[model samples]
Target chain A: MGTKAFWLATTAAVLIVFAASRLVTNDYVFFAGYVVLQYVVLATAWNILGGYAGYINFGTSGFVGIGAYSTVVLHKLVGPPIPVLILVGGIVSGAIGLGMGYLTLRLRGVYFGIATLAMAIVVQTLVTNWDFVGGSRGVYIIRPAHVPFIGGYIQYLFLVMLVLAAVAVAAARTIERSVFGFGLAAIRDDEQAAEVSGVPTLRLKLIAISVSCGLMGMAGAPLPYYVTYLDPASAFNLGYTANTIAMPLIGGTASWVGPVIGAIGLATIQQVSTVTISSALNLLIVGVLLLICVVVAPNGIVGLVRGKRRRAGRGG
Target chain B: MADDLLSVDKLGKRFGGFVALDGIDLTVRAGERLGLIGPNGSGKSTLVNCLSGTLRNDSGTVRFDGNLLNGLAAHRRTRLGLARSFQLPKPFRSLTVVENLRVPLYYSVNARPGAPHLAEAAVGERCRELLRLVGLEAKADRQPQDLTQIEMRKLELARALAAEPKLLIADEAMAGLSNSEVDNILALLMRLGDRGIAVILIEHIMRAVISFSQRLVVLVAGRKIADGDPHAVVRDPEVVRAYLGE
Candidate 1:
């Protein structure tokens, strides 16, 4: 789609979602919708570094957990507004991401991935020991009955997540179209070749990681308010890491639309299956779907569709 | 000496006590076509790597356009008008043929100082022109995987050319091509040289090297055995003994 049409379609989609949320009286839909939107943000964020640059970052939970804990600390210390807390969370995660990139981005392939995984463990340990943000025991967050402008607290949280998701998708789309995107694609194809082609690979990778981690943190900042509780275990949940990585991989890792499609599809399936079968089966479902996608459609749904169209064009 | 586009002095590299390039000195004047011929494991690739900043020398200086390039990274060197085509074609597999050229043009050429900023249309136009120069204009939209052996080599050269480099080191660019393909690549290298870009053609194909090179340098056992006119260098006793032992 053209840039103007894309924005028009996105704005219309956001409005439709907002209007639809107003018509529904049940709080369950908003709560479920919040989870899906949050995944959209996480998946898109991860795709920036992982999909575009071909740097597998296994530390989604670390950045998200940092954002969640940032919100908790801020809420306890000064009780800033949620938006302010989100911004603080993003800055904190972005800084950490930048530091991590500087230190570990020199390692390529699996070693770099292993470093990110280690980062998650280290963050989890630190959060576990810290008593201010509720240590291992966790802390309860008292929520007001309603937010001022938005009637219900859940509705307000859902709206925030929806906006964040839209912004992440838009940003990813912009990066995919820019010179920066081409550079990232070159890095993904071959880093040595990209460097020889005069691409500043290190700078681009740092930018990608910073943006990606910042978005993840932003998505996590409001989680304390959504869940009405926070702890190291829930905040640094492996589910966040698994789902964020799996969504983009299963949806398609190449484009902005891939993560969105993957997140919505996978999140809906998980939500439905959690209710129908058992909550324990959620991770199982994700694992199975990931495997199936890797084997059957390695390029994800978008790639599959494109491949079909190309084949049909040739045949005709 | 100051007019030399690339001057390497006392360049040395070692891999865990095994000397790869030892105390090598070389120079190429602006727009010169210098062929570098060496036996397998004779450190030709290593020398190219050092000159292109892909590998760092243990000692010595690589002065490119009179600037010291010892610690500079490969991409930095590329931005400063130095480029190389890999021995194996490393085209961006996901991008189309034209898009492959766009990477270097967008990054290297556009990044050059005092160069006019290229618009999207101008960039596209340059990409087509590069494809035509390499005789791959008809396959502009094709992927690298779809390219034939010669076409892949052409794309490799085209990618290096996109940098608008003052110096290009082509590492075995015509390795597996047929006779006509070898001549085709030699002609392309000559065309590039005519445009005032110094070229270091590292090849084992003596016929192509002899026909293309204005000067030839021979490396054997990580040491320069001969450096002079192509015919004189080939006829050197040391060069012949290194190649075909009597």
Candidate 2:
């Protein structure tokens, strides 16, 4: 599709969803929808570096926590609007991503993954110790009585998340089609080959990590107001890491649609199962789904569909 | 010497205490076809790596097209017109054959100043032209995984050429190919020479090297044993004893 057409379609789809969602009187749906949309942003962000560049970042919580705490710190200090906090959170997390990439990006494969994991633990510990943002004691955020136009604060949060998800998806699609995306794909295939082929691998990787972390942070920026309580444990929850990584892997990693499909599908399932079954089953489901995806459909759903289509074409 | 496209002086590289390359010096003029032959583990690949900025030299200097490449990263060295194919074909498996060519063309060739900025359609046209040059136009849409061994090598060469290098290093590009396939690669290299792009053909196949090289250099045990006309270099007592000796 042409760029203009793609944007228009995306905008229309988001607006349609927003308008439809308003008809629901149950605030529970909005709360659940907000969580799903948040995963959409997180999964899409993770895939930019992990899927495209083949640099698996295991520190999703680190970036997300940075964003969440950036909001807390900003809200406590300046009492800025949520939009402003989101932007600040993104910049702060992106800067950290850039710094981490510069320091440890030289390590490849498992080593790089280990470094990122270590960084997450370090960030969590630092935040847990600092009392200014409540540290381990946790901080409470007071939501406004009513959101302008949106009515309820939860509904407003859901609307904002919906917009963020659309923006993330659009950004990913643009990168996928651009020359930069090709560079990242080359890096994914072979770093040495990419370098010799005149790709500035280091530069491309730094950009990928920065953008990925930035998006993750933006997704977490509104969490303070949504949850009303912010603590290191909740901010750096392993659930964010697990869900974000699993969603992309289960849906597909190579395309923009994959993470969205994975997030919405898995999040919906989790929400439904949580009410009917057990919350503990969520991790088990994600783990089993990840294993199945890896073994049966290594390229995820999109790849599986393409593979089957190719097979059918050949058979015919 | 001033016009030499690549000049290496006192190059030295060591892994631990074992020296892979020891105080080597070589030069290739613009459009000069030079053959670098050596026994197995004689540091031929090491020299290529050092020159291409893949590996840093312990002690020495490499100047490419008047630019010092000592600390330059491999990609920057490529941007400065130094390009090399790997000993093994390293095509991007996720990309089609044509897309493989586009990576280098988009990043290295079109990225250079004064090179025409190709539109998206022009990029496709240029990719097709590259595939045709390497005679892989019919397999443009094929993934590297689907290609034959020889076809992968051709794609590797095509990828290196996509950078529009002033100096192209083909590191064992014809290895494991059938006799006819070797000739095909040789002919391709000769065509590249005709275009005034200097090539370093590193091979153990003497017949191909002798036919393709204007000058031949032999390395044995991390030291240059012979450097002169191809026929004379092959006949040199030290080169014959160190390399040809079974």
Candidate 3:
């Protein structure tokens, strides 16, 4: 691992250890932290291609659902533990992403966006009708049959997610600065111009889709173990889609930390607001916030901050 | 004949029954500077699009550096050392001037096996050199939105140069520039050509066309009406009829 990767991994290790200790010490904290961190993983995964390459992927739930459903099916079939199941989910979802790219990456802008959204809907409908994973009724993992000595499974699960989230972030930044990163950025800026400049548009896009979906699969694989239950509605929820995309947009889609900050901020806000407001209106709040961000600070919080700092230095 | 560096033979293109480019034929030597010009909608840009692989030629072959370029994607054509500038500049709006150049420099240079791979700092240095070449180094950190029309044109040239192309087709590169600005762009194109990069200058500015072109080619209604010495091609009776209607 490079310096950035090493530090990120270390930070994730510390966070996981800290969260595990908290799980042992406080049940309420574990409940809250787990939910927020889950968003971080999904949002970070979405950021890899969406933020870096400027390719908007609204079908995030499709990949997540694939991960969750595959985890359940694989575990049921092969009897592997949770960790191995998540890896299976990642591979399956990545394959699906690769396939999806072939069908839709050539389309630009609204067309590409709608194609991904349609894909998510199709996957959701498929899982809802399939009875193997209990169809719409859902499946229960039964809490992984309870590992007796593990006093803080929730924390351990959270730690696992944290490591994944850090990996996602580091990987995203690395790709952003790497040769492929420049290629994607060029493709985003001007597809024709990028091509004319010798950027391999299709190859780069396929690679991005594969990696992006792989990360989403990893982010989602732990859900069966985390919730101890899975249903078509829960597994293929559009809520995941909204969180994965909106957080990146609200935080700054082009930067690594944009999705991280957006996920943590929005997740915590939604968590708190649910107590004082209606849970059903959470997405409504997010929708309104996204609109405001687009109009006022299209660059997101990071852009807003940088604009402020630049102004402040001039003023001083 | 060394197979000509680029051969566009019997190229035909159409947009839904409207013949945008009708049976065009042209060729360029390894380091020859050529100018292609026509009135608006005369198929110059369309030919550029077809030759560069942005649009596949309907009935022709575009062999670049001796490689057949039919049915290849646009970027693949670029990797074969063919690059073009748009009539309107299209810089990556979000990137700094240097970063915009880096995308092409990174792609074209690092993509080819034996080519040099520039680090970020080295890429920045090449970007600055390109900027200085076009007299836009002072605005390296500025966004495209911040550039004046002439500066934008220079930046466009700089972006194309980043690819280190064998043939650079500049489409109306001086379209909106002042007289002096036009001279600046013409000078820059000349400088690129002097570096042994064959150039295709597509311009309507008669002086820029005449002065910059070693040979002039004219198109009327998508057909090549004339291709010869600049002084004689413009005076050809058919070229006159096509231009001023005799």
Candidate 4:
């Protein structure tokens, strides 16, 4: 599909989903749905760098922390609208992403992953020490009871996250088809070969990281309002990093749809299990599913499906 | 020297105590088919690496098409029209054979100064043309793993050519191929050279090298020992000794 049509379709689909979601009278549904939608954004964001560029970034929480903290800082200072907060959050985290890539892209392989993990730790430590945005003590956000059109603040956050998810998916799909995306894919395959083939590997990597982190930050921007209690521990949670990485791997990293599918499927399962089976089983569930994906379908669900289709075609 | 397409003066590279390339001097004319032959650990690959900006040379200058490529990145050098195929085929394993060629076309060729932005159709056309040139049109959609060794070599060459390079350094492109496949790659290289693209074919296969190169430069122990007519370079005593271990 053309880029324009794809975006239009995506926007339409998101509106439909949002409109349908509003019909549910239960506020808890919005609360759970918001988390699932947030993953859709985070996983898609992570895939841009990790899956597409083959640079595993263990700094999802770091970027998210930056975004959430940016909102908190802005909320304390100017008290900007949530949209402005999201934009500012994206910019701050994207710049950090670019800076991180500059410092560590040369490391290659697991070293780059280590550098990102270290960056997350560093960011978390900074957040913990900074008292302005509530350091180790944590801070409370008093969100307005109801938004004008959305009725409830949680519903507004849900609507914002849904839109962000669509945007993230659309952006991913656009990059996947562009020349820039092709260059990124080349770097993922073979860095030296990509370089000699005229791919600006370092530059592409920086752009990938920046975009990935920017979107991640956008996902995190709403968290301060969602939880109403923001702390370094929760904002910089390792759970965000793990889920961001796992979603793409479980769904398939080769295409943009993989992360969306992985995020929706995995997040929904986690959400459902957290309610039905105890919240303690969340990590255990993620672990067992990830293990299954790694063993039974190393390439993830998309790869597994593709393999089956190929085999069936051959057989027929 | 100014008229030469590529000129290297006193290029040196040392990996700690071991000297990989020591003050190597070489020049190639535009569209020149220059075969670079060297024994194992003789620094032919090292020289290629320096020229292509894969590794930084510790000393000396490399002037390619009037630009002094001292600290330029590999992609920058490629954008300046220098390209190379890997000794082992490094086709983007995830990409199909044709898509592998698209990478260079997108980044290198289209990125050139004053180059028109190629339409999507044009890019696809260019990829197909390259596939046809390398005789991989039949396997354009096939993954790199599915290709035979020779097909992989062809894909590698096609990928390099997609950059529309002024100079293509083919590093052992014909290695491990059958004799007919060697000739096949040799013919392909010769065809590229005829299209006004200078080629530096680094190969262990003497027959293919001799038949393909108008000039042969031999490297022994990180130094040039013989450089001149292909036949004479093969017969050079030092080159013979370097190969046969006299």
Off by over 4 Å in 2: none
lDDT string for model 3 (B129-149, tens) is 898888887999888999998
lDDT (CA) per prediction: 0.93, 0.93, 0.84, 0.92
Tens digit of lDDT per residue, candidate 1, span A182-220? 999999999889999999999999999999999999999
Preferred candidate (lDDT higher): 2 or 3 = 2
Best by DockQ: 4
Candidate 3: regions farther than 4 A off = A1-13, A16-20, A145-150, B119-122, B244-246
lDDT of 2 at B5: 91
Q: Which scores greater on lDDT, model 1 or model 3?
A: 1
CA-based DockQ, model 1: 0.86
Candidate 4 CAPRI classification by DockQ: high
**Which lDDT tens digits does candidate 4 get at residues A1-316?**
7777887889789889888987889999999999999999999999998888999999999999999999999999998889999999999999999999999999888999999999999999998999998899999999899999679998889899888898899899989988889989999999989999998898999999999999999999989999999989999999999998999999999998899999999999999989898998977878899999999999989999998998898896
Candidate 2 on A177-266: residue-level lDDT in tens?
899999999999999999988899999999999999999999999999999999999999989998999999999998988999999999
What is the DockQ score, from 0 to 1, of model 2?
0.90
Fraction of the reference Cα-Cα interface contacts (below 8 Å) that each candidate reproduces: 0.76, 0.81, 0.80, 0.98
* TM, every model: 0.99, 0.98, 0.95, 0.97
**C-alpha root-mean-square deviation, each candidate:** 1.0, 1.1, 2.3, 1.4
For candidate 2, give the lDDT of residue A199. Answer: 94
The Cα RMSD in angstroms, rounded to one decimal, for candidate 2 relative to the true structure is 1.1
Model 3 interface CAPRI class: medium
TM-score of 2: 0.98
Q: Report the Cα interface RMSD of each model, rounded to 1 decimal.
A: 0.6, 0.5, 1.1, 0.6
Q: After superposition, how far is residue A255 of candidate 1 from its true place, in Å?
A: 0.7
- Candidate 4 — number of clashing residue pairs? 0
